[model samples]
Target: MNEKRRFRQRLKDFDLTLPESKKEYNRMLFTPVAQVYSGITRVLSFGRDAAWKRKLISLLPEIPEPRILDLACGPGDLSFLLALRYPSARIEGIDLNTDMLDRAASNLARMPGNIQERIHFFPGDMNELPFNDGEFDIVSGGYALRNSPDLGRSLAEVHRMLKPGGYAAFLDFSRSSRKHTGRLQLGLLSFWGRLWGRVYHGNPEVYGYIAESLKSFPDQAEFLRLLEGFGFSPVHYLPRMFGMLRITVIRKN
Candidate 1:
């Protein structure tokens, strides 16, 4: 059997599920290749992924001596960006995956002395962050919520960590509320994801996980409600790639 078919068969045989599927695929994405994840992400998003991140960064409200946390910060892409832009900010990046953190540390090693001191990474869970309540001035995560096993619990942790009036922003894959439009966009994304996997990853089924995760994740409006229920006010969002991706900015009130 071809590798793609075999991959599908294995998932079928094991009866793998949504968040589980997401978890497995994410591990695979990071396992075989850690550094290339960002490159492939930018490519698959048609080069607009960085733009979405920039939008999220721009939404960050000015706060005195901001203490920032980048949750599920895969390879510290956004975290690095934060360090570059906010020299005075203390940035802590947390993720469950050690290899990603290792790579993040390596990247941090290359920076000048002050930046290296300001940005750091450690192992932590987003659902139960280790810090005390109201620890951060801003919390930003890229593409983490969609993969979160419990979005409500994760958002709660985010809210708990932020000082009142702190901002939390995230960039992630988003979908249309309309079923047909959602389907079409996901189809195109899945096709591209699989193609990237086949060409660069030698595992076409790996990136197909994107489509599956999107289908299982909350839509734009639903997620906005989730933020509000979590006690995040002044919630706002921006879409890019014609709604293929989004940046949601929320603040604790």
Candidate 2:
């Protein structure tokens, strides 16, 4: 099979949609190379990813001990940060990738014991989360929303998992008005992702598929409406890094 066909097959196998679910994405697509690929992508972003997540956390709703859910919590960065940000709150990290979950668990384990106690990482499918209805005060995704098998379904799932009046933060790539910057950033990202995937014995198909997926991702207005359709009110978005990425926040009514 060709690269596209293979990637499509993998996506179908894992139930990933256009934005591309890293969790359902092939284990061979990552594996031991997961850490290396993450490192390379972080370097390519000039270390902006974590800072962006931090900023999003800072903007979270002012609730005492909000229960936060990190969907597709690859490597547990957002979940770990939330744990530290709200030490008294409950935080859960869920991903479909067992290997990635293992890595997340390992990273969490190395943290100071107290911090580790505040966070939990488990395998979860975004389309049908395990938690009961209205269990979380906040639900967040880091670059995971795009790959959801059904964006609307995923949003509904997040909404259902949140308590009434709960809020959510979804950060992912976007088609920025600054076309030149977006193109350059994407080109550099593709090059490094593919190169390093090969270097670390990862699936190069994933890199190419990501480029294609980004090209086909929904624009800001469409995404906002999707959130609104899921009963999210007070929806807002902040385009970041010259519009190459964006973070959308929606409050559940």
Candidate 3:
């Protein structure tokens, strides 16, 4: 089997089951391979992902300088962007991947000294975030939501972290296989991802994971329902590229 399929089978065989302990889950999913795969893609993807991230970050309110939390901030790109955009905002980059946190710290250290102060990096578990209630004005994640073992539980944690009127903006692939729309888009994404994968790292695992995960994802409507069940209101989703990608924004009451 191809590397991607192998990884999928591994996840499926385990049912993508995370350990009851957050620490163990972190050790498994955030392995060295995952970190390298993510870090390289940040560059190999020609930086288009930043634009998607920017779109998500733009959803926050402007009245007060908001404290932002970036979940699974591999390599710290999103955290850095938030700090750059809202210079006065308090920003934290939290992830299970220590390697990614290390890279993020290196990235931050390399920045001009002034920009480094606005960002904080820490090893964190999304299922059980280590922050107080109603702490963040905005919480965002990129390509990270779908990887959660329990999407609903992850969303619940996000909700618990936000203060009333705070916003949660997230991006992830949605299962689009229902219509010809989803399949065509998935095929194109798979082709490009695999091509890039081979050229950059020759490990098809990354591309294959994208395809398999999207195939296994909940439909957009179901995802919306999940969000609502978490007590988020004003839920809105923008389906990109014929539903292959999605950005969801919801506000906590």
- Which of the two, 1 or 2, has more TM-score? 1
Where's the lowest-lDDT run of ten residues in candidate 3? 14-23
* Tens digits of per-residue lDDT for model 1, 1-253: 9965666566444323444554555554555456577788878877877877877887776676789999988788899788766778999998777788888888888878998888889987787788899999999999888767567788999999999988998888889988899999899878988898788767766677677678878887887877888899856788888898888888898
- Higher-scoring candidate on lDDT, 2 or 3: 2
Please count the clashing residue pairs in each candidate, in the order shown: 0, 3, 0
lDDT of 2 by residue, 188-226 (tens): 657765765455444554555565557556666676666
Q: Which sections of candidate 2 miss by over 4 Å?
A: 1-28, 176-192, 195-203
TM-score for each candidate, following the candidate numbering: 0.90, 0.82, 0.82
Runs of candidate 3 with Cα error greater than 4 angstroms are 1-14, 17-47
Model 1 C-alpha RMSD vs. true structure (Å) is 2.5
Q: Could you tell me how far off, in angstroms, the CA of residue 14 lies in candidate 1 after the best superposition? A: 6.6
Q: Evaluate all candidate structures by whole-model CA lDDT and list the values in order.
A: 0.80, 0.74, 0.73
Instruction: For residue 210, give model 2's deviation from the true position in Å.
Output: 2.2
Which has the greatest TM-score? 1
TM-score of 1: 0.90
Tell me the RMSD of model 2 versus the true structure.
Answer: 4.1
